[model samples]
Target: MIKSRAVIARGKGEPVEVVRIDLPEPGPGEVLVRVQACGVCHTDLHYREGGINDEFPFLLGHEAAGVVEAVGPGVPDVSENDFVVLNWRAVCGQCRACSRGKPWYCFDTNNADQPMRLEDGTELSPALGIGAFSERTLVHAGQCTRVDPAARPVVVSLLGCGVMAGIGAAINTGGVTRGDSVAVIGCGGVGNGSIAGAALAGAEKVIAVDRDPKKLAWAEEFGATHTVNAAETDAVAAIRSLTGGNGADVVIDAVGRPETFEQAFYARDLAGTAVLVGVPTPEMEIKLPLLDVFGRGGAVKSSWYGDCLPSRDFPMLTNLHQQGRLPLDKFVTEEITLDEVEDAFAKMQRGEVLRSVVVF
Candidate 1:
C-alpha cells in the first residue's frame, strides 16, 4: 500500500476535500498508474452535486494521463514507465456489445478489483471508475491506453474524456466529412473539441454557438470558422444563414440542456445529422415535435464518450498532436496542483477556463 493525496467529495452538495488516502497494490489484470496530470472536468462537479449518483465519499477527477508504475498478474502489452491516457471504457470482450464487434458500446466495462481507501478504511468510489485526482490510482490494465511519451501530459489528459468525446462525436458519431458544414452548440470544452474535430474531419465551415464571448473566442482558436452568440441571436437561424439558409450538414449539441438541444435539432439541414454529446440531467426532458422528427429525415443520436475506441483513437490523436494535425494543447487553459482542484472547480463554474489540469 502507498499513501497518496487525493480530492474527495464526502457527500452531495459538499465541497471537495484534499485528503491523504491509501492505495493498494494492483491485482490481476490491473495496473497502478502514477497520475501525472488530471483534468478537472464538469463530471467531477456533477459527482459532487449528486448529479451522477448518490455515491459518496466519491474520489473525483477522471480525465488523466499518467505513467504506469506497476502491472499486475496477467496484464499484457503494458509495463512500468509507459506513458498512458486513462479511459473509462475498458471493454469486456465477452459482453454483448463487444461480442457483436462494437466495443465502443461495451456494456460491461472493466475496472480495478481492488479498492483505494480513505485513511479510515472507507472504500472510496472513484469517479467514472477512474478517480484520477490522486498521486496514484489503480485501474484495469485496458484503461491505460499508451500514447507518445512526448505528448504534453497537461494537453493529452483532456483526451481521456471531454476532448475525445467531442472529436469522436464529429468523426465517429456524426460522420462528419470533407466539405460538410458543421455547427456545434455550446462552445465549452466539449463543444470546442467538436469544432476542432470537425476541422480535423475537413469540414468546410465550422460554426460555434455559445452564450459566453470568451468561450466563443476559444472556439475560434480551436478552428471555428464562424461564431454565434446564442444569447444575442437565434442560433438555429444564424446557423442556417451561415450555411446558405439550409442549415449545417451536422449539428452537435455539447450543452445538454433542453433549449440547446432544440437549437441543435433545428440547426441541421434536412438530411444532416444531429449528435447529442452533452450529458443531460436525469430529470431534464426534451419534448420534440413528432412530425418534425419524422420530417427532418436525418439521424438523431447520442454519443457516449464520442463513441470512441480508446486504444485506437488515443494513440492516433496523440500522433496527430505530435504531427501538428490536431491542436490538443489549446484545451489546457491552466495547470494547477491537486490541492487546487476545488478552486479549479470554482473556475469551471464561473467559466473562467476551458480546462484546469492538476499537474503532479
Candidate 2:
C-alpha cells in the first residue's frame, strides 16, 4: 500500500481538503500511475457539487498525463516509465456496443475495482474513474494510452478530456472536413477545441459564439473565422449572416443548455449535423418544435468523450502537439499546486480560465 496526499471532496458544496489516502498495489489487469500533471476541469467541479451523482467522498481530478509506475499481470501495452494520458473509457470488449465494433460506445467501461481509501479507512470515490488528483492512482490497464515521451505532461494532459472532446466533436461526431462550414457555441476549452478541430479538418468558415468578449477573441486563435457575442446580439442571427443566411454546414453546441441547443438547432443548414458536445444537468430539458425536428433532415447526436478511441487518437494528437499544429499548450492557461484547486474551482465558476493544471 502507498499513502499519498490528495484532494478529497466529501459531498455537494462541501469543502475539498488535502488528505492522506491509501492506494493499494495494482491487482489483476490494473496499472498504477504516478501522475505527472492533472488539469482542473469543469466536470471535476460538477462532480464535487454532486451534479454528476450522489457519490460523495469523491476523489477529484481527471484530465491527467502520467508515467506508468507499475503494472499487474498480463498488461502488455504499457510498461513502467512510459509517458501516458489516462482515459475513462476502459472499454469492455464483450459489451453490446463493443461487440458490434463500436468500442467507442462501450457500455461496460470500468475502472479500478478496489477503492483508494482515506487514512481513516473511508473509501474514496475517484472522479471519472481516474482520481488523478493524488500523487498516484490505480486504474484499469485499458485506461492507459501511451503518448510521446517528449511531450510535456501539462500540455498533453488537457487532451485526456476536454480538448479531445472538442476535437472529436468536430472531426468524428460532426464529420467536419475540408470546405465544411462549422459553428461552435460556447468558447471555452471544449468550444475552442472544436474550432481547432474544424480548422484542422480544413473547414472553410468556422464561426464561434460566446457571451464573453475575451473568449470570442480566444476562439480566433483556434481558427474561428467569425465570432458572435451573444450578449450584444442574437447568436443565431450572427451565425446565419456569416454563413450567407443558410446556416452552417455543422453546428456544435458546447454549452449543453436548452437555449444554446436551440441556437445550434437553428444555426445548421438543412440536413446538416448538430453535435451536442456539452454535458447537461438532469434538471435541464430541451423543448424544440416537433415539426422542426421532423422537417430538419439531419442527425441530432450527443458525443460522449467525443466518441474517441483513445489508443488511436492519443498518439495522433500527441504527434499533432509535437508538430506544433495542435495548440495543446494554449489550453493550459495557468499551472498551480494541487492545493490551489479550491481557488481554481472558483475561477472556473466565474469563467475566468480555460484550465489550471496541477503540476507535480
Candidate 3:
C-alpha cells in the first residue's frame, strides 16, 4: 500500500480537507499515477453538496495530468514515466456501445477494482471514478491517455474535462462547420471551450452569452465574434438578431438550466442543433410546448464529456496546444496547493476564476 495525501469531502455540505489515505498497489489492468496537477472542477463541488449522490466521504477532483509510476500486469499500452492525462471514460471494448463503434458512449467504463481507504478503513467513492486530487492515484490503465511530454501538465490537464467537453460539443455534437453561425450560452470554462472549438471548426460567427461582463471579454479571447449579455438582453432575441433574424445554425446550453435550455431551444434556426453540455440536477425539469418541439425541426442532444474518445482526442489536442493553435494554458486562472481547495471552491462559486489548479 502507498500512503498518499488527498482531498476528501467527509460528508454532504462539508468542506473538503487534505487527508492521508491508503492506496493499494495497482492490480491487473490498473496503473498507479503520480498526479502532477489536478483542476478544481464544479463536479467536485457537486460531489461535496450531495448533488451527484449520497456517496459521502467522497474523493474529489478528476481533471488531472500526471506521469505513470507503475503499471500492473497485462498493461501494455503505457510504461513507467509516461506523461499522461487522466480521463474518466475508460472505455470497455466489449460493451454494446463499443460494439456499435461508439466507444465514447461505452456503457461499462473501467475503474480500479481495489479501493483507496481512510486510515480507519473507510472506503472512498472517488469522484467520476478518478479521485486525482492527490499526490498519486490508482486508476484503470485505459484512463491514462499518453500525451506529449513537452506540454505542461497544468495546461493540458484541462483537456481531461471541461475544455474537451466544450470543444466536443461544438465539433462532434453540434457538427459546427465552416459558414455555420454558433451561439453558446454560458461563458464558463466549458462555454469558452465551445467558442474556441467553434472558431477552430471554421464557424463564420461565434456568439457568447453570459450575464457576467468579465466572462464575455474572456469569451472574446477564446474567439467569440459577438457578445450577448443575458442580463441586459433576451438571449434568444439577441441570438436571432445577431444571426440576421434567423437564429444561429447551432445553439449550445452550457449552463444546464431550464431557462437557459429554453433559450437555446428557441435561439436556433429551423434546422439548427441544440446541445446541453452542462449537468442538471435530477429534480430539475422543464416544460416546453409540444408543438414547438415538433416544429423546431432540429435535434436536442446531451453531451457526455463532449462525446469524446480520449485516445483519439487527447493526443490530437495536446499536439494542437503544442503547436500554439489552442490556448489550453489560458484556462488556468491560478495555481494553488492542496490546502487551498476549499477557498478555490468559494472563488469558483463567485465566478472569479476559470480554473484553480492544484499543483502537486
Candidate 4:
C-alpha cells in the first residue's frame, strides 16, 4: 500500500479536504501513476454537487499529466518512467463499437477495477475514474497515453479533458475546415479551444460570444477573429452580422444553458453544423420550434469527450503543442498545491480564472 496526500470530497455540496489516502498496488493491466499536474474542471465541481451520481467520497481532478511509476502484469505498451496523460475512457477493444472499428464509441471502457481508499480503509470513488488530485493514482493501462517527454505537464494535461473536448468539437465533431465560418457561444476554455481549433482548421472567421469581457479578450489570444459581448447585444444577431448576414457555417453552444442553445440554433447558416460541447443538467429542457427544426437542414450534435480517441488525439495534440501550433500553455491561469483546491473552486465559481490547476 502507498500512502499519498490527496483531495477528498466527502459528499454532495461539500468542500474537499486534504488528507492522506491509501492506494493499493496495481492489479493486472493497471499502472500506477505519480501525478505531475491535474486541472480543476467544472465536472469535478459537478461531482461534488451530486450532479454526477450517488458515489460519495469522490477523489476529484481527472485531467492530468503524470509518469508511470509501476506496471502490473500483462501491460505491454507502457513502462516505468513513461510520461503520460491519463484519460477516463480506457476503451475496451472488443466492445461492439470497437468491433465496428469506431473505437471512440467503445461502450465498455473500463477503469482500474480496484478501489482507492482513505487511510482508515473507507473506499474513495474516483472522479471520472482517474482521480489524479493526489500524489499518485492507479488506472487501467489503456488510460495512460504516452506523449513527448519535453512538453510541460501543465500544458499537455489540459488535453486530457476540457481543452481536448473544445478543440475536438470543432475539428473532430463539427468537422470545421478551411474557409468555414464558425461561431462559438460562451467563451470558456472549451469555447476558446473550439475557436482555436477552427482557426487551426483554417476557418475564414471565428466569432467568440460571451458575457465576460476578460473571457472575450482571452478568446482573441485563442485565435478568435471577432468577439461579441452577449450581455450587450443579441448573440445570434452578432454572429450573423459577423458572418456577412448569412450566419456562420457552424454554431457551437459551449455554455450548455437553454438560452445559449437557442442562440446557437439561429446563429448558423442553413445546413450548418451545430455542436453542443457543454454539459447541462437534467432539469434543463430546451424547447425548439418544430418548424425551425425542419427548416434547419443541418446536424445538431453533442460531443462526448470531444468524440475523442485519446490514443489518436493525445499524441497529435501534444505534437501540436511542441510545434508551437496549439497554444496550450495559455489555458492554465494559475497553479496551486493540492491543498488549495477548495480555494480554487471558489475562484472558478467566481469566474476569475480559466483553469486553476493543482501541481503535485
Candidate 5:
C-alpha cells in the first residue's frame, strides 16, 4: 500500500475534502495507474451532491488519462509505462449483452475489487469505480484504453465520459450520416461533442440550441452551422425553419429537462431520430402526448456512454486528434490542481469554462 493525497467527499451536500488516503496494490485483473490528468466532470459534482447515490466518503474524479505503473497477476495485454485513458464501462464479455455481440451494452461491468482507504483505515467508495482525483488509482485492466501519448491528456480525458456521450449520441445512437440535418439541444460539453460528431459524420446542417451565447460560440467552433438562442426564440420553430421547414433528420436533447425534451420531440423531421443524451433528476417527469409519440414514427433513444465501445472508439478518436482532424483541444478551458476542484465546480456552474482539468 501507498499513501496518496486524494479529493474525498465525506457526506451529502458537503464540500469536498482533499486528504491523504491509502491506496492498495492491484490484485488480479487490476492495474495501478499514475494519473497524469483528470477532467472535473459534472458527474463528480453530482456525486458530491448525493445526486448519484449515498456512497460517501466518495473518492471523486473519474474522467482521467494516466500511465500504467504496475500490473497484477495474470494481466496480459497491458504493461507499465503505457499511456491510457480511464473508462467506467469495462465490459464483462460473458454478460448477455456481450453474448449478443454488443459489448457496448454489456450488462455486467467490472472494476478493481480492492478499495482505497483513509488514513484511519475507513473504506472509501471511489466515484464511478475510478476515484482518480489523486496522484494514482487502481482500476480493472479493461478500464484502461491505450491511446497515442502525443494527444493532450486533459483533452483526451474528457472523452472517457461527457464528450464521448455526445459524440456517440450523434454518430452511434442517432446514426447521423453525410448530408443529414441535425439539431442538438443544450450547449454543454456533451452537446458540443454531439455537434462535433455531427460535423465529423458529414451532416449537412448542424444547429445548436442553447440559452448561453458563450456556449453557442463554442458550439460553432466545434462545427455548428446555425445557432438558436432558446431564451429569445421558439427552439422548435427555429430548428424547423433552419432545416427547410421540415425539421432536422436527427434531434438530440442534451439538456435532459422536460421542456427541452419537448422541444427536441417536436424539432425532428417526420420519422426522424431523437436521441436523449442528457442525464435527468429522478423527481423530474415528462408527459408527452401519446398521439404525438405514435405519429413520430421514429426511435426515441437514450445514449448510455454514447453507446460507445471504448476499445474501438477511443483509439479511433485519438488517431483523429493526432491527424489534426478532431478538435479535442477546444474542450480544455483551463488546467488546475486537485486542491482547486471546488473552485472549478463553481466555475463550471457559472459557465465560465468548458472544462477545468486537473493536471498532475
Candidate 6:
C-alpha cells in the first residue's frame, strides 16, 4: 500500500479536506494511475453535497488525465507509462448495450475490484469511480483511455467529463451537420463545449445563451456566432431571431433547469433536435404541453456523457487539440493544487472560471 494525499468529503454538506489515505496495489483488471491533472467539475460538488448519494467519505475528482503507473494481472488494453484520460464508463463487452454495438450506453461499467481506504480502514467511494484528486488512483484498465502524450494533461483532462459531454451533445446527440444553426443554453464549460463542437462540425451559426456577460464572451472565444443574454431577453425569442426567425436547427440545454429546457424546446426549428445535456435534480420536473410535444415533430434527447465512447472520442479530440482545430486549452481558466479545490469550487459556482484544473 502507498499513502496518497487526496481530497475527501467526509460527510454530507461538510467541507472537503486534503487527507492522506492508503492506496492499495492494483488487482486483476485494474491499473494504478499517477494523476497529472484533474478538473474540478460540478459533479464533484454534487457528490460533496450528497446530491449523488449517501456515500460518505467520498473520494472526489473524476475529470482527469494521467500516466499509468502499474497494471494488474489480465490487463491487456493498456500498459505502464501510457498517457490516459480516465472515463467512468468502462464498457463491458458482454453487456446488453455493448452486445447491440452501442458500447457508449454500456449499462454495466467497470471499476477497480479493490478499494482505497482511510487510516481507520473505512473504504472510500470514489466519485464517478475515479477518485483522481489524489496523486495516484486505481481504476479498471478499460477506464483509462490512451490519448496523445503530446497533449497537455491539464487541457485534455477536461475531456474526461464536462467538455466531452458538451461536445458529444452537439456532435453525436444533436447530429449537427455543416451549415446548420445551433443554439446552446448555459455558457458554462459544457455549454461552451457544445458551441465549440457545433463550430467544429461546420455549423454556420452557433448562438450562445447565458445570463453572465463574461461567460457569453468566453462563448464567443469557443465559436459562438451570436450571444443571448437570457436574463435580459426571452431566450426562445432571441434564438429564433438569430436563426432567421425560424429557430435553430439544433438547440441544446446545458443548464438543466425546467425554464431553460422549455426555452430549448421552443427554440428549435420544425423537425430540429433539442438536447438536454444538463444534469437536473430528482425533484425538478418539466411540464410541457402534450400537443406541443407531438406538434414539435423532432427528437427530444437526453445526452448521457455526451453519448461518447471514450476510446474513440478521447484520441480524436486530443488529435484535434494538437492540430489546433479544437481549442481545448482555452477551457482551462486556471490551474490549482489540491489544497485550493474549495476555493476553486467557489470560483466555479460564481462563474469565474470555465475549469480550474488541479495540477499534481
Clashing pairs counted in every model: 0, 0, 0, 0, 0, 0
List all candidate RMSDs to the true structure: 0.8, 0.8, 0.7, 0.8, 0.7, 0.6
Between the candidate structures 1 and 5, which one is better when assessed by lDDT?
A: 1
Q: What is candidate 3's local distance difference test score?
A: 0.95
Best by the lDDT measure: 6
CA-lDDT, candidates in order: 0.94, 0.92, 0.95, 0.92, 0.93, 0.96
Name the weakest run of 10 consecutive residues (lDDT summed) in model 4.
187-196
Better of 3 and 5 by lDDT: 3
In Å, residue 9's CA in model 6 sits off its true spot by: 0.3
TM-score of 3: 0.99
Candidate 4 TM-score, true structure as reference: 0.99
Residue pairs in clash, model 1:
none
Put down candidate 4 lDDT per residue, 1-360, tens digits, no spaces.
Answer: 988999989988988999999999998999999999999998999998999998899998899999999999999999999999999889999989999998888899989989999988999999999999999998999999999999999889999999999998999999999999999998888888898889889999999999999999999999999999988999898899888898899998989999998898899999988999999998999999899999989989998888899999999999988999999999999999998999998998888999988887
* TM-score to native of every candidate shown: 0.99, 0.99, 0.99, 0.99, 0.99, 0.99
Q: What are the per-residue Cα lDDT tens digits for candidate 6 across 98-168?
A: 99999988999999989999988999999999999999999999999999998899999999999999999
Q: After superposition, how far is residue 163 of candidate 2 from its true place, in Å?
A: 0.7
Per residue, candidate 5 scores C-alpha lDDT tens digits across 214-307 of 9999999999999999999999999999988999999999989888888998999999998999999999899998999998888889899999
Q: Which stretches of candidate 4 lie over 4 Å from their true place?
A: none
Candidate 3 residue-wise lDDT, 1-360, digit = tens: 899999999988988989999999999999999999999999999999999999788989999999999999999998999999999999999989999999999999999999998988999999999999999999999999999999999999999999999999999999999999999999999999999999989999999999999999999999999999999999999999999999999999999999999999999999789999988899889999999999989899999999999999999999988998888888899999999999999999999999999999
User: Please, what are the lDDT tens digits per residue for candidate 1 over residues 24-117?
Assistant: 8888999999999999999999999999999788999899999999999998789999999999999998988899999999999999999999
RMSD, model 1, all Cα superposed?
A: 0.8
